[model samples]
Target: MPPADGPSAPPGGDEVDRIVAAWRRVAPDLDVEPLEVLSRVARLAHHLDRLRRGAFAAHELETWEFDVLAALRRAGGTHELSPGQLVVQTLVTSGTMTNRVDRLERRGLVQRRPAPDDGRSVLVRLTPAGATVVDAALADLVRAEHRMLAVLPAGERRALAALLRRVTAPFETTARG
Candidate 1:
């Protein structure tokens, strides 16, 4: 049921709408238009992170752990990649990647072995346990995501995804530290 407040916002308006409304009332000249889109994106990202945390935790994994595992799982049949490669795919510093790998190693979710071509470098391989956990977590994540987007039709979801990709393309292409 909707809130029985003093005055209801127009159809489909939400909390962000209320905020924008207030900002509009306060600063009639300033261009707060961007907030209408970016603010909701920020709020949605928060919800997504929370949902992912719950989904991954149920599979005994952390968000970072799932990221590494998912990277490996997408690395074709071998399901392995060099630490440098993992760093690139995960957008983490090499040092951070090493620490992440160390923690994951302790949890028995990944294993390190000498690279076939490079004697000095080692490749990180996802253990069977890792694959199972990541796969299950992914399934759970997808189901939650599906429910979240259920309000939108299938075509809208695809279009939204494409639009999001366009919005994210610049960030994805930019160098990260």
Candidate 2:
């Protein structure tokens, strides 16, 4: 099926088109518009997830490791955040975050230190090794995503990004509230 915007045909549109066609045949009156866009998004997400996993694995890191390392790396100079802050940034439960920190510490990818402002709380800092691995994994993931988007021209890619932002912004805005 042709994309709502862009070229006359999708780069590899067999499955969505076939599925949509079957739905139309079985239920001609039903509006399957949502299926077209959402099904493709789900499939693309699955593909992207696999690509990211492979990219991280190539650097000897898991998705959780990359997530925690990235949060600390983005914290800048000190390259550290309290466990509470990491939990917020990584969107994991505090218990899960602690487990992740423990594993990363064991791997020598991160270190823990007492928070200067609050003696009872600790900070998780990215070690040199963690920064190196996360950075490489992020670079690989970007390259892989770019390759996956090769079918779209620059203008169409921008348009699609804008469209997706419109679709996602509501959920994000609601979450912040």
- Model 1, span 27-74: residue lDDT tens: 889989899899999999999999999999999888999999999999
Each model's C-alpha lDDT? 0.91, 0.89
Off by over 4 Å in 1: 1-8
Query: TM-score for every candidate vs. truth?
Result: 0.91, 0.88
Error of 2 at 41 (Å): 0.5
Best by lDDT: 1
TM-score of 2: 0.88
